[model samples]
Target: MRGIQLQLSQTQKVRLQKALEQLESLSSKVNSDASVTIADSIPVNHEDGVLKGHGTTDLNGEVVATLCGVVERVNKLVYVRSLRSRYKPEVGDIVIGRVVEVAQKRWRLDINYSQNAYLMLSAMNMPDGVQRRRTALDELNMRCIFEEMDVICAEVRGFQHDGLHLQARSQKYGKLSTGQLLTVPPYLVKRQKQHFHHLEQYGIDLIIGCNGFIWVGEHVEARDDMVEDQVNQTDPQVLIPNKDSVSFEEQEKNYTALETRKYICRAANAVRVLSSLGFIITLEIIKGVFELSLSSNLDIHDMLGSEFCVLVAEKEAERRSSNKKKR
Candidate 1:
């Protein structure tokens, strides 16, 4: 759905069509009857008892899907996995979000979820790496840390009385900078062990947030609170600078390096291609495409071209096939 809006030659169109067909073929073989639309009755072994799970319901003793997507069964439980929907945060899932509002004691973030997520002041670790309680002065300085429209990375911390709550207790989970934020459909991002990656080769960082907000930019070292002894503790007064006094020189420091910026664009375009093809996103696949572009000497700007896209599709088909054979 991403680059297809561009003008295409007949040959390019044909290649894209073929690649899409191949993807459908592979998906169908995995579970021909597993894909279903809304209100479709799920096929089941009738002799045994069954339990309806999320995205499913019983209608006259028949199991039916309430959503449109693949059906999965685990033991006696059956459920539908929606292919397109707002982000549903699981506790502990890493999410990248934007500051939407600065409320009384918390910051509201738009995390692509059904509701805006809350980041209470009490849930955060002090910038000075102190373990003491957050004082009223700390609450007053919240805007200095994260203002409206600023991007942030955080962890899901279950629901509070008002809405979904997020936490940034660790160093890595905090404000994001020098990055390009891109949004893909939520279904394409699958949860895994790690969501943060530092691409040392390209000097870039990639955070594939579970809510589908991706950050591509120059890598920054995750701040270590344990190393506070090496440097003097930052004075609260100095830490909370007046917004009006912020200088141009300080802001210029946030600008990324030329080479790192190029890498960021290339990586972002790679993600665009994968999302357009509806492929499950993973580090291996993403890195494969990045290396493919570099090895072929393809210009960074040309990575999103129709010809390059077709090449990527063909390579992906071959790669998945090889993986299956190994398995």
Candidate 2:
């Protein structure tokens, strides 16, 4: 276990050490014998026709691991699940990434993968919500839609000859604003059916990217651009908007409530604490930590202190113990 560097008193150090030791003991009970290092031979029954899977290769008829990870066996099939590795893009996985480059009709993003993922203009829905073919005008105005360093949420389309591809066809999939982007170990984030979460109480959106790029931002309602465009086109008053109306609209767009910002920070801090403890990042776990902080009346900054880290470790150890008992 890696200890976080912090200026701690003797009591705090002892408490943290105890909590971490308890956590480690619980983890050892589950994965002690299953863990493997590179070049380690994986014992298997050859009489059952054992098949070698990812991270394992046949070395003179012996199954040897190519990576350091935990060995997982699903019946006869076995593979090593790396503890820390780059994001492996799969079709239909949701990912949050920053726009690194805007080329001719496509955008390149660094998704913490071995290679940059590509988001082609033709693969995504346009701002107008039209299904027409992309034109030269659209290609020229690509930067206006997504410039350099703009954070975006997209779905993995698949791998092509060029590289990994992404698509943003839904309103929920687009540029993220007014939030903090946190990068954690990719293995900490597991794939789930629902990655996009709107905390109505906090008035924020939590996007858990499978790629370990999490976005915690102010929640924006999904709007149908096609319907909105039709309404504006038919309404003569909307076409010739008054100055007062335009100013109010701009103000509404630019303003972020102070309370919302506070919640965003609180939520972000919860993630930081969880990541620092090397806990699995999940929505339920995040909500539990956030609510615990609120109940304890801990300031956002104080959540990063040694006491909170110890508290989290103890709570996690207790939670896992109870869960194992139930099982």
Candidate 3:
């Protein structure tokens, strides 16, 4: 209901309701009473003292929710995980953010948090992937590494004197070129051990950034920009006509392969549809949706059609039911 704005026929509405009901039924088995709305009192009457946590408040000796989300009880601790909110970064969380500003010693990134995240030049690995100290020249040429508006992937490196800090200490965490950045409610993406996926069959890399910024693009090996001391990088074969480079025609020519691009579009559309339905996004589930599209022979553009939406909902209902039975 967060972003759903569909006008369905009576029949479609009934079917959707049935599917959603089935999903609710499956979810109800797991402490169904845990769902709460704002100001709702959580049903916890334990003798022991319960520590109030985020999204919770003490109201007249009762624990009440400050957000509309499901209540979770971890041992003696009780808290509500808000279904709608910006990303809450934890240490080691892999995130995708856009460079918003090049500050004196850091790059401010808009990573869907309440405040901008900082990526200090000193925290990042050197351009050559060497363990060298950051130099003043590096600070001067900060834009060269990450200009404003560039999509970057990094890890949360704990808070600092400057605030929420991010680090790109590995080859995998740096500038993200030639990709589609998809935003969804951060809760939809479950924290997993691995977020980066290389779909070899499609020749695309799927980076499920924990901050809800998903990236889909042509697959490329991670290599340091400084490591490329190749002759071509040092000198151009042809003379440039003007200071303005990367002409429109040349840029198009450098685009991902035709088939790979098609796959990227299809994957991105599949993700869009899933996010619209408020589905829990995981690598396996996303791949299942892609296979569903292929099996139904739905065109890339038709994945968003009303019929497809209904089908996806029904399919999800079935999948959840099957999982419940397995459990």
Candidate 4:
């Protein structure tokens, strides 16, 4: 939706309108009563000792919603889960952020939270994967590891006295490259066990950040480079040179394939359409849209057209209706 601006014909507009109506109808049947807006009163029995949670306030004697969201009840506790709001971080959640500042012993990242998250140098593993004390040399070379405006992926390490702390002890967590980052509403992305996806067919990696940042990039196998270095050092006969010494032109030869780049654009467009339609974002659904576009023989750029948007709405409506019937 951020980059898509379509000019639709009259017929396209009518079809899109009808499809959206059907989608709204299907959604209403599932959660019509559960959804609430700001200042809406929540029904609760006072005799049971109700506890008000986030997004709810006591208005005289009634429990009124302080924000527009869905009312959630957990035993005696009640709260409103906001449908659209800034990201609220929790411990152990994976997030993608951009480096905003490089301070002493740490780098501050903009993680789409109330404040920028902090990534302490000591918390992350060194490039050599050797667990040693962070010396003064390490502090001086901090910019070499991460400079300003570099996009990185890390895990939330809980709040400290200064602010939110992050860690990147694993090989999977580090600076991301050769990728396009898309931002959506945090609520659209639901937390799951696996957020990192490697679509083998498309030859790309997808990272659905819990903080509403989605990254589509070329896949790099997760391996410890230090292991390879250790092997080189142990074997005197091995003539393999250091990867860091590779010439820039040699690295350029490994650029992403043209077909893979097309697939990336298609995958990115699928996410854009789904987010614009207010549908829940998931790995399976994204792949579905992508495959549908391919099956229809639509060009990568045409996926952003009004007709495709209507088709996606209709497909989602049918899917939801069938799922409801199955239940």
**Could you tell me every candidate's TM-score relative to the true structure?**
0.87, 0.86, 0.87, 0.88
Per-candidate local distance difference test: 0.83, 0.86, 0.83, 0.86
Model 3, range 30-72, lDDT digits (tens) per residue?
A: 7568778899998776687778888999889888899988898
The lowest-lDDT stretch of 10 consecutive residues in candidate 4 is 225-234
Candidate 4: how many backbone clashes?
0
Give the Å error, residue 102, model 3.
1.4
Off by over 4 Å in 3: 38-46, 54-67, 226-253
lDDT of 4: 0.86
Question: How much is 25 displaced in model 2, in angstroms?
Answer: 2.9
Tens-digit per-residue lDDT, 1-327, candidate 4 = 333467878987787778778777887777889889989999999999999999999989999999888899999999998877778898989999999999999999998888999999999878787787887666766776788998999999999898899999999999888778998889889999999999998899999999999999888898543223333233444454544686788678658888888888889999999988777899989998999999999999999888898889778778877888899
Candidate 3: TM-score? 0.87
Q: Model 2 misses residue 95 by how many Å?
A: 0.6
What is the full ranking by TM-score, best candidate first?
Answer: 4, 1, 3, 2
lDDT of 4 at 223: 56
**Model 4, residue pairs in steric clash:** none
Q: Once model 4 is optimally superposed onto the true structure by TM-score, how far is the C-alpha of residue 93 displaced, in angstroms?
A: 1.1
Error of 3 at 142 (Å): 2.1
Clashing residue pairs in candidate 3 (N, C-alpha, C atoms within 3 angstroms):
none
